[model samples]
Target: MAQLLRQLERICGDDHVVTHPHALRTYESDGLLQYHVTPRIAVLPGTADEVREVVVACHGAGVPWVARGAGSGLSGGALPVEEGVLIVLTRLHRLLEVDLANQRVVVEPGVTNVAVSHAVAPTHFFPPDPSSQIVCSIGGNVAENSGGAHCFKYGFTTNYVTGLEVVLPDGGVVELGGKAVDLPGYDLVGAFVGSEGTLGVATKIVLRVIPRPEAVRTLVAFFDHTSEAGQTVSDIVGAGLVPGALEMMGRLSIEAAEGAVHAGYPPDAGAALIVELDGSGAECDARFDEVVSLCEQGGATGVRIAADDAERELIWKARKAAFAAIGRISPPARGARADRRALA
Candidate 1:
């Protein structure tokens, strides 16, 4: 162990290697705090080559290792192994390139999900925005196929990822896809994205970006019953109106969120639905009216539509805050886990 530690230190510098008992504890668990295992060592490589060297050293020494991004994943995918190396990728942060002509963006694994959209803002944006986008790293997003709000229209993390530079388990480096679309050979890129880090470690990534919509509208519809909210969602979708986001929240989460962020959710509401629609101004205006009418038909007791971007952002803030808000009210139950099988 000492020999491998020294080798790792030599590869990534003494400052980058974390072996202190207290510091190692920092990598013990990811967002899933219920599970914890203090790693023997942790390393933060500063570049693609450094990452490969660290992985190579671990492979040669027969030590298992885990790759971690921002450690915001709740699925325990970034959980540190008891006796393994925890390779933190945040040091690799870089927006390598942006090509609007090609609609492609190149980034290192450590770039946050929201950063992609910000870098291409006003003209284009990355669409797979998980609730944790602001902090979640693109590498982890690829591993988990994270999806939020616009996922209903733009799809998951896998959809935006066009290419990856991977360091295999045995220290071999390979390119899965490219800036150009529809590459020949096996769809290794597809198999690797959501593998939760089993296939390999992504070093560099190529992402697809889309042009921003001309107009957008957001609304929060309140219903006396969850069934009514559910029916309202059905009505909108059935009417061929594709909402950018159609998130439903029940009384419990709604109350928790209101208590935390005060996002203007009605107190007496049994259920709330956050619906976002985007397109040309005329199209959004035409469809927004129909969506509002359908909410009424579905038995909505009240509805709040975002009057401006500020209001729309607040409405989304409430929805995204629901998970953490609940935690403030009640600590996570022992042996508890998120039911990933549940639909959004």
Candidate 2:
């Protein structure tokens, strides 16, 4: 172990290779706190070369290793193996390039998900917006194939990922896919994505972006029962109205969000459906009306439309805060259980 540490320190400065007990504790577990095991050592590599070097060192030493980004994964995908090394990628955070003409952006593994959308906002945007986008790293999203409320329309990480620079398990580096839509060979990119870090570590990613829609309309409909809201969702789809996003929250979730963000949800409503429609102004306007009518037909007691971008943001904020709100409202004894269920 000492010899391995020396080799790692030689590859990346000693300051980047963590070994002290206190520092190691921080990488012991990811967002899924229930399953945790302290790694033998944790190393922060700043470049793809450095990452490859560390992997080589671990490979030669016959030590297992795992790559971690932001430690925000809820599925224990980043959980460390007890006798293995944890390779932290936070130092590789840099938006390498933005090709607006091509509607694609290239970023390193450690860049946060929200940063990508913000970089191309108002004109174009990256579409896979996981609830943890503010802090979750893009590489982690690729590994988890994460989806957000808008996934019902835009699709998940696999859809937007056009290319990847990866460090294979045996310390080899490889590039799969590219800026083009289709590659002639095997679907290696698809297989690598959603592998939960078992395949390799993504060092650089090329993501496809899309032009912003001309119009966006957000609406929230209150229902007397959750089943009614579910029916409304099915009815909207059955009617062929493809909303940009459709989310449902039960009374307990509504109360938690209301307490945390004051999203103005009705306290007595049994369920609330936050739906959004986007496209050309004419299309959104027409489809939005149809959605509202369908909600009413499905037994919605009340419906509210977001008046502007600010209101739309607030509505989405409340929806995103639903899990945190559960923590705020649950008793201490049941908080862990509630969080587990929410993540599940």
Candidate 3:
């Protein structure tokens, strides 16, 4: 362990390698919180070349290393392997290119998911928006192949990634796919997208973008039972209507959201449904009516459609914060911080 730490310090500066117990605590677990392990060390590499050097060093020493993004992951993808180094990728973030004509953006793996959309939103948008887009990195999305409300219409991360530059397990760097669609070869990009870091580390990626919609409308419906809301979702899909976002929160989730953010959800409702339709104004209006009718058919007690952008954003914000809201519902255990210390 001492030799590996010395090698990492040599590869990256001593300042970039964290070995102290207090400093390494943050990398012990991801968002899941259930599984935890304090890595022997955490190394933050500032560039792809540095990442390659660190990986090579670890490979040479036969010490396993885990790749990590923003540490906001709900799954155990970023959990440290025993006695391994956690390669934190936050420092490698940089948007390299935005080809508007080709509708593709090339970015280093550590760039945040929302950063890409924010950069392009003025001109267009990247459509695979996970709820954690504001904080999660594109590289983590690639590893998890994450999906969210908007995916029903825009598709998942795999649909947007056209190419990847990777460091294989043996520390060899290679490029898979490219700007051109349907590159002549096996689907390495597809296989690597959702491999959950078991395959290799993504150093860079080419992402697809979509034109910003001219209009967006949000509608919320309250049903007596969750199954009724589910039926409505099925009916909407069965009618061949793809909503921009479709989200359902059960009674507990509704109470949590209302208590936390007050998104105007019906506190007494058994289930709440949030459905957004985005497109040209006329298309959205027509689809909105169809959605409302479907909800009514599925036993919706009441419905409220957002009349402005502010209201729409509030609805989405509540949905985005659902995970945190749910957490507050269950109070942390007594001496939780102390327990975490004991585990460490």
| Every model's TM-score | 0.94, 0.94, 0.95
Which 10-residue span in candidate 3 carries the lowest summed lDDT? 177-186
**Candidate 2 lDDT:** 0.91
Candidate 1: minimum summed lDDT over ten consecutive residues — where? 335-344
lDDT of 3 by residue, 218-277 (tens): 988999999999999999999999898999989988888888998888888999889998
Q: Worst 10-residue stretch by lDDT in candidate 2?
A: 330-339
Q: Which residue segments of model 2 deviate by more than 4 Å?
A: 179-181, 331-344
**Candidates 1 and 3, the one with greater TM-score:** 3
Candidate 2's residue-wise lDDT over 265-326, tens digit each?
A: 88888999999999899999878889989999999999999999999998888889987788
Give lDDT per model, in order.
0.91, 0.91, 0.89
Clashes of each: 0, 0, 0
Candidate order by TM-score, highest to lowest?
A: 3, 1, 2
208 in model 2: Cα distance from truth in Å?
Answer: 0.4
